[model samples]
Target: MPRARSSGSPNLACRSATTNCIRCLPQVEWEAPMADFLKLRDRMVDIHLARRGIRDSRVLQAMRTVPRERFVREGLEDFAYEDSALPIEEEQTISQPYIVAAMAEAAEIQSDDRVLEVGAGSGYAAAVLGQLAGEVFAIERHTALGKLARERIAALGYDNVDIRVGDGTRGLADQAPFDAILVAAGGPDVPAALKQQLAVGGHLVIPVGDPGDQKLCKVTRITESRFEEENLGAVMFVPLIGEQGWQEDGRRAASNHLPGASKSQSLPEMIADAAEDLPGFDDPAFGRLFDRFAGRRVVLLGEASHGTGEFYRARAAITRHLITHHNFTIVAVEADWPDAATIDRYVRHRPHRAGTDKPFQRFPTWMWRNTDIQELIHWMRDHNDMVDDMEARAGFYGLDIYNMSGSIGAVLDYLDRVDPDAAKVARERYGCLTPWQSNPATYGRAALSRGYAECEKAVIDQCRDLLRKRLDYAKDDGDAFLDAAQNARLIASAERYYRIMYYGGAESWNLRDTHMFETLQNLLDARGPDAKAIVWAHNSHIGDARVTDMGAARDELNIGQLCRETFGSDAALIGFGTHTGTVAAATDWDGDMQVKRVNPSRADSYERQFHDSGKSRFLLDLSPERHDALRRRLAEPRLERFIGVIYRPDTELQSHYSQAILPEQFDAFVWFDRTQAVTPLGPEHHRGVPETYPFGE
Candidate 1:
């Protein structure tokens, strides 16, 4: 997330003993120096405006005055002066210098104008606007980014800026009547609130349309009653996520308090309404569906390798919620019982620093490290007497220790000792010495070892010892594992484990393979009628693929195909994608590229405006063979305006490649009469030119 500029200094009042001293301090140094900054800034302006045909001077000057280096990450300060977006925390990005300039210029800011900026990332654009406008109000949705932006702005001493934390699409309704609005994020359409908030003659500049294609549109209030819309150029941005934007979709399954009644409403509406529901207390039907295992006996299954932050956060939330608010009696994490016994002792004695060591440093296990988990454990321990009583009444059973593979190993060792009839199966399945080598033959060799035969006898003795120990301390055997419950949820860090385990083999683990869907289906089937499960996965995995080609199935079978085969009509799924602008960067390139921005001629009709001008504008559609060849040929950066094409195998090959072209590879595009290649929306409106047959007009 980009940081915002902070609001200025605190006021001070002082009284002197001998004399009355009253003075206002000099305005804090909020404004960064523009002297040495202007040169590099001007160089960027030339690259974007003069070289790339950015006609808006106000945009250029704003770019010039605002020191972009101040808003960028410290390491990326050198590239700050360049016209390319940089990644910030949370996987968000600060817009490129030219894009900021172009967008700000398109907004048509005036000296006394009040501007509203959506996606207040890094506060770079807001800082620039502070120099151009009277009041700049920037909204950042991400809470952390919002705080960072406020800190940066305060450091720079920008007094004219007001940073607000809120959803951007909704716009600050209380501060209605903005002279101009700039949305940094992309959306499928201009948000209605932004349009309504624009004062007469105000301009709203935003990138609008689908993720694959978007237009930087400048909407100006032409009169009190009408507005003029001009397509500026093509651009890409992150999706604008909020109530008024694209919604996340998925199924919600739990105890039915009227599940059938809520089925008629749209999934988007459900998600929007459910946003207010507390994490643990949401209505079971919808909340449990999205959250998964809301009020159930869950055994969190963790892999040795930790996953991404999102996965960690989700698992943590689920574990916390279950322990705090459910009838969950037992938690069986994958660790050995002896290791868990040590953890239990640590939790009981050193509550604050329980198991705060390697491997056990994850949540619940390392309870002392996390304040929330520590508090929950304290509460549970305090009420242990009552829990023990309940356990006695219910005839509580101690958690069973079954390290599926380790148990198999123990069984194999026993088979070797007894020379049982099923000894071959044990040898083939559980005799491997190397933990990494899971082949059946290795298991057989291990089962045949003399050491394995001895170990099998020892394993049975150990189980008996554990059982006897439990019986000796039998006052509340059920409550013994309660301390471990915090870390014990059957949540796998990698979905691949679930796929491999359920499929009984590792042959179908490819992300691109449709077998992934089959695995999910098997998971659903295994859950059975009494059990309900929610899958937290990418939009491609859960969405109905038949209607939309925007999911993973575009590379395999559509979402609808999988849903029908696996979930049937009983399961509901939603697909979500952020529509941040169009392709600003080349698919294969790392940095940003400067593409020419063209507008429709006033004299030409909407359709005729799609035609080629004398200026260098051409579209090139390449065949698969040609595309691969051209990609290697024009791998270097060059000055040209052309659209690029990638073959979509899921669609009919000819139909998919029919209008596909290498626009970046060509000098200019011409409309081929025979191919009917002119874009109905046109390159001028859609951001790239249409492919033509001949080289020139």
Candidate 2:
């Protein structure tokens, strides 16, 4: 618990006093004054840190002593003490109080220990550490942020703490052999330099792994040659940028796979050497590897991340080629049916349907609403316009099962236009779900808690009724009837999907993939049996999950697995990967979107294997007929990365990589050494913070 400082005492300075000065005084005795802030700090420690298992007394005291408000931006002072990372200068953030406390505690700071902190964003963590240690040396990569942090630390009267502007990865060599070190950002692994700088018996705390997912590890220097490590659980942080770490320009430093110059090429080296060069996507001749999958009925194109520009552009180029040369008619994506239907109509050159102009409007709108996708959509429409055969025009569709309420609305809208009696029946049936309109998971939980009788029955009844009148509805409008029938089916499936997702296990994963595969089949059936379709989805969803450790652990299967099962020789999966660059992602679910810098791919991962190849862009054909060393190397299991619409570069490793047998997962692969984020339509379209009730500060 924290106690108030004595107001106007020699040890304490009052805001209303003669001078506007703030300082932390070292005093043994003080009279109580301004109890409000003192109580608030104590309360924060009690509820946010202590209750959460942060038991270090020194960390608690330092947290209580530091005025968190003084370190934050002017307007954001009110939120400073809250248990969340607040934005600071240069887009850097002052880490949450609990996190700072946890890291400080993990470091096991002694009263006389000399500490070094990498990435001293706002000097907040250094200040806290300074209270526990005798001296603290903090380094920040951004000059402006470092300067500001220095000024703030000086103002707080931390004479022993030093703030320097330089690359944090390259620890201060001149002041080597520090008693303890704390890295505030994530890295692929512990930087060799930082490890060497730790004194014997000293401790080092760092968040290690990819940017999106990381584990807080505590390393103790056992000897000059050995260090013991312990994982302190998962954490998220910015990238550690420097010569020995992620490059500032977002490109990974050239891989050192060629160490010992005389050594022969490794497996990754062989794969890279054999890869075919790929010109820019804008070139008419891009994606020459598609020539190998010429006769494939289903070509599933996968992206490492949703917002990588090269992934989108390359996929679009391949899709365009398939559409023009191979007569591929349908383009199915991993999205909701109702949302993608809007794009379907637009691409088919059909009259712009009311409310169907804009396609994606979900939490991660940037995934499908970016400039690259917009350009692809326009190309589809232009291509459709030039086609003479109506059946030859490519039609877009979504295969995911995430839209229960939206599909219900679409079904009713179709029914209202086609049959008023059917519409009334649907309204009554779907009325049971209207309460949980915003969240289907809540509906599923409620239904599972008591009973699922009425809701399940109603949705099933609605679907059956819609299907029963399909012929009659088609007599007037075939496309409208088909759309309505699909929507009805989607409602029933979505109910089951949501129910299974809440309950947990492989059932939900299987159910969603099964629905997507079934939907693809339905599209082929409707397209007169000669239909060829292309799929666009994350590599996790598009790659054969059976060949990966992720799928084996979860007993999960994805669309790629189903495609291989059904189409066999006729299906081709092409997966894409990138080494590093910028990405558009949110900090948390529904949090404001930011253009985060992507840390380079892990050296042990497949992306590094590609990066080492030295090609900016390349494609590898994995067909057995090629009989190359690359194909043989790719067949071996290796850690592969995958990023979805929600990317947390700070904690990437835990969120992204999985052991994958590359050759078994995909028939072909696309590699980009570096990539850029997809540009959003506007700031308003970026992620927005979720709504939550605020507790008074």
Candidate 3:
């Protein structure tokens, strides 16, 4: 007979970070599950929960112990550990890990507390809560999902959990006075039954408002007939179907309309009324926007898309003001390091070899190799020439870490010039990667497979050797040595990043952003304590992820999150957006550049509201002192469009729009009602740019 499995689940049994904890089951019974599942669960707890501020220890332990794969469909077990939501039976889904963690952390579960869970699709969240509380009662609306959840819970040995099938909107009255309640679906408003069932001092966390758009609200029972509500942030969920919620058909009565849609004035009228608050982009009065952030050490500039001309021009204009008036020192962007270094050499008048003059030649080249960016480079060069002190000159650099091959070459070339012996060792270690230089993904696929050796050790050893010999090389050429060392670090990080990407999980995304943030920090430290810098990247990178679904669903963080964590009030983040326009993008990866037409803003989006304002262009300050009406409009969650270097108009909504709490994500926002694509410097650029609006409306 096979040895009995551990009485306690893996989560409760392992107190350490590693998945090497001994199992009670026989070797074969344990190897299959513990090999992949236990290791992934441990990583999920460390990276997704601990690093993201998910504090409650009980919540973390429960999350780590639960076998998420058992709760998902068999074929999708590979994706069970991911932070994203996955489909379950009866057209339901298991809540994303971060979302569940957020709700659990918000509930502040006590050791002896009883919990109530609404819309328990897969019973995954219930199992997690069971670990934190004394008992958990989960209600599901779909009969099949309820039955499946019960079976999963029993099979997983969660004896503290109980499953029931009913309209979760009404809650479980028979088991009243729950210490905490978590609703997995969105409702028009907080359900009365759920509120009444909560004991004093208990919390009810639910997504409240429209189904496709909602606010995560936490309601606390203060006393008899007294309760408090706090808007946690924006969220999106399917409708809660039942009495006192959405109708069985998912429609509301005529008297009850979507949130913000029942106002007496039409959308156009509301925009016209707020016209006084809209300031022209070119207005001299608008200069005060950056003026308020005068003493900030870092200012992050964000663009909705990579190829919007207005975004590039606007950020450049602001950057110029900062350099000339505020004494800002550097401009770092989301491009390859070597490519931006070429621009840095040009601006500082350093000699550059002929072949290295043009730096950007990759996919989405228009992002940096365009006329708009060309003008900025020229201006920086002229400005630097006027400055006598080298330290005072504004410099350009790149913070992204996607150029592994280029970085490897840069490191080798530097070592070859300074220390031939070190170069030989470097070449030997890097040789392990040379075979897959053109496409790192090929190596990643192999490394992630069974029995395939990883080059991680070799790359790390090479980085260590370069750092050990840094002083020797620095004596000859300090800047070159510094560049070489940074490249070595980038290569090691990128090698691991590519491998993680092959797993199709959040680790790779997190690694890339973390690398960029570290690069920015290094640049700042190298510039001295008094230096200031401005960052240019997509809104998705510059906007705080904690307030968006990106964070909740994917456990992803970006440069903006790092800045906020590191600099706090010392950093300012500003975002840009547009309603409709032409954008320079490609149909596919490495495809031909095209000036594609951006779809008009959807009806439920913030862009639609801005477009209706009848202003061609404007800036809306998001500070607390702004007009209450303007703040109110932006405070509510709404659809926000995000276009990258690639665009597909047909799948715009599915691919781009995300529900976002505008005021919470950025300090200020700039909007252009109508815009056009950036003009590429080369002749081949306009092959996709049409000559007229609608090609002549």
Q: How many residue pairs clash in each candidate?
A: 41, 11, 1
Instruction: Encode model 2's per-residue lDDT on 1-697: one tens digit a residue.
Output: 1242433222111110101111222232323334655766776787668866799998899999988877887655544544656667887777778779998988889999999999998888899889999989999999998888899999989999999988788899998889999998877678888999999999999987655345688999998999999988656577777776676665444431224535335555576667888977777678555777879999999988777888888899999888888889999997889888877777786655555424566667777777777678778888998987777889889887777777887888888888899899889889878877667767766688867647888999888888787678889876677678888878888888766554544676677778888889888887878889999988888889887753654467888999998899899999999999988766544456678787898755678777877778888888777746556545644567766655655445434555677888888899888889888765453335222100001
Candidate 1, 475-571: lDDT as tens digits: 4433332222211211111112222322221121223224334333333333344333333332222333332222211123432245455545344
Listed in order, each prediction's TM-score against the native is 0.35, 0.61, 0.64
**Which model, 1 or 2, shows the larger lDDT?**
2
Query: Which stretches of candidate 3 lie above 4 Å from their native place?
Result: 1-288, 449-454, 625-633, 683-697
Model 1 per-residue lDDT at 670: 22
Best by TM-score: 3
- Between the candidate structures 1 and 2, which one is better when assessed by TM-score? 2
Show where candidate 1 strays beyond 4 Å.
1-38, 223-225, 248-664, 667-697
| Best-to-worst TM-score order | 3, 2, 1
Instruction: Write the candidate numbers in order of decreasing lDDT.
Output: 3, 2, 1
- Model 3: per-residue Cα lDDT over 556-632, one tens digit each: 78788899999998888898888887998775545678999988986557787778767776666676776556566
Give the number of colliding residue pairs in candidate 3: 1
